[model samples]
Target: MNAPYIHGRRRTFSASAAVDTQNAVITSIKTDDGATWSDMGRVLGKSEDRAAAYANTASPIDLPTFLAGCHEWGGRFADPLLALVGGRWADAGAICTGDEAAALTIANLLPAIIAIEADNLTEPHELLPHEVLIRRVHALTAIWLEMIATEKGRAR
Candidate 1:
């Protein structure tokens, strides 16, 4: 689901989803100017099999909450690619195989993330957008990838 958000602007967007438990039906809602949300009603019932397929395919990916939040915020900030890389790094760190280099790389990223958060608090929103955070995240991801590669090399 994707929507545009402009501060102090009147815009309308719709969100819809269909589910098949006992029946196939769609539920939808729309918000005008970020206010006065109203139901858009369900339409286009599909075959139960089709709905089931959709449900099966739509299962959420398992990820840590903090990493997921970072990805969501990255999308809102219009830098999903970078946020995704950061999320991958977080995932690698979580499942790290007790390698010293991987541990050190993950530790190094903590201060960078903290510094980015600190800078965000002081700068205007426009001045310190997600791009800046993404750059740091990308750097962290590179370090993480290098550490993983090094660990793999040592294994062989």
Candidate 2:
């Protein structure tokens, strides 16, 4: 006689890799279509080196601050500028132009995604879990919505 055996899959998370992917995505978006670091750098009111350094970090602490500053400077366009830097979908184009509730829903979910990446993933170098990566994509979309909302709010 043999007893049945079952094993559950172990889930892993990688905050570092998730953050890195996020940075790479953002960098790609910001540099797209002849956009220069100096143009974006103006948002931070800092020299190119300083702006690049802040953008390259894995931490999100500076992102919110930077975006707020950009809003103060560039007005409605700032939303799209920040969205581009956050790596929203290419189709997302500029900032979101409609749907306030939905946008906020997406924005609020980013922390959970970050938490998942911070918790349930590990590879040879500790990459984010597949689920977390998916969440990051979703978070990027949400950020786009937030940007749109920012622009719309300013318009009204």
Candidate 3:
């Protein structure tokens, strides 16, 4: 296993992808103040797609869990401006609280990003829904800004 890196909220996150048939992709997160590591569970199997190809796989991450977490965090009320850009109201703050939230947001964006890539590869003229794209971008931006703020706070 590789060394874990600090993700946020003083948590260390790490993952090990399968290299052989006997291995499985594993992910775990540990809090700086805690002695025990919390397992985030397996991300992939050796028999499954290669770890390097994860980005190209459809539904590479857990979408339902991520979406549910976002909803649970009250993302719908986090940002009023989202209504203007995407014709929908959502609270971006709901998922910008910490490193885990940031990870979730990134995971949430992956499938769409992959789809965009697939579209580019297959049908360059395919038009994605502008509002959907706007909402995702807005959410990602909000999370990014929050992370920066958190990091700045740490600096002081």
Candidate 4:
């Protein structure tokens, strides 16, 4: 299989047609609302050309530093990054503490995993495989980590 990042780029291209460049960590979004480049440029503290260039091909060395800016793009970068790590946005989703998240993740995952093993799918992907119950544990792990971090006041 290809590297995780290669798959990430593939999914990014598949999910958001605007990320038309390889190795691109971000994309210039142009929805019906407006052109996002200018605002994105401003947010990243760079000119439009500079922002576009960074979005097009953020080198691996610069990616870590640049990602701090990308996070400000809201879900534009978040969603793709989550998907890269086998996840999706859950901000407007469930609200639960680490304990609750554990119970919820287990309560939700057990049956589906059993069903999958038994070759019985109760429902569709609900949309994407990433949205399936099989991924609940992974997402929940991340959630719980953050929840713990927050509880300990170590969140960044």
Reference-based lDDT, each prediction? 0.37, 0.52, 0.39, 0.53
For 23-61, candidate 3 gives per-residue lDDT tens digits of 211111112222121222222222234323333333243
TM-score of each: 0.20, 0.30, 0.24, 0.42
Report the Cα lDDT for candidate 4: 0.53
lDDT of 1 by residue, 4-83 (tens): 23332243322222112111111111122121111111111333344233334543222342243334333322232232
RMSD of 2: 18.1
lDDT of 4 at 153: 62
Q: Clashing residue pairs in candidate 4, if any? A: none
Per-residue lDDT value at 107 in model 3:
71
For candidate 3, which ten residues in a row score worst on lDDT? 21-30
RMSD list, candidates in order: 17.7, 18.1, 20.2, 10.6
Alpha-carbon lDDT of model 3: 0.39
Q: How many backbone clashes does candidate 1 have?
A: 0
- Local accuracy of candidate 4 as per-residue lDDT tens digits, 61-102: 145434555456555555655555455455555773443456
Superposed model 1: Cα runs more than 4 Å off: 1-128
Query: Of models 1 and 3, which has the larger lDDT?
Result: 3
